[model samples]
Target: MSKLSIKPLADRVVVEPAAAEEKTAFGIIIPDTAKEKPQKGIIVAVGNGKKDEPLTVQVGDTVLYGKYSGTEIAIEGKDYLIMRESDIFAVL
Candidate 1:
């Protein structure tokens, strides 16, 4: 697991989004403007859940989320998403 300098405060998590697809099934290369946002990512950091509900997700877990789920942020020259745990839809 990576040791990040930033930590989430509540049910928020930091996710490293998977790279956007470079090509289609038919071997067509996708242009930057045509490439879609990735919805799956690996969790890098997480916050403790609310007092009563501890978070089920943990660092290093690969997860699926909505297309427009989290807020985009940059740390240490890398892109990451910070969103509430509720933004995550499922573990992969």
Candidate 2:
């Protein structure tokens, strides 16, 4: 699959969440568990940045996210998150 390098405008970020492991706490390895998506991700693509404003983050940065922040997107078989820069809770 071909990857796109389109950058978002304003306060937006492109995140590709890491997949969660497929195992229960009891080590049962439930199918559902394996299918669940991970909450954490690395910053793959970033926006052009705040227009005429300063930003504290950049591409390749890992960040903490709110449970309900961002829009989910699937591109070329990969999952990604598109959220407002302000939605980012913290950078790790």
Candidate 2: regions farther than 4 A off: 1-3, 21-38
lDDT of 1 by residue, 1-92 (tens): 45899989889999998776665443434344654533778899999888998899999998878778889999989999999999998886
Estimate the Cα RMSD of every predicted model relative to the unseen true structure: 5.0, 6.5
TM-score of each: 0.79, 0.69
Among all candidates shown, the one with the greatest TM-score = 1
* Candidate 2 Cα deviation (angstroms), residue 61: 0.8
Error of 2 at 18 (Å): 2.2
Clashing pairs in 2: 22-34
How many Å off is the CA of 48 in candidate 2?
Answer: 1.9
Model 1 Cα shift for residue 42 (angstroms): 0.3
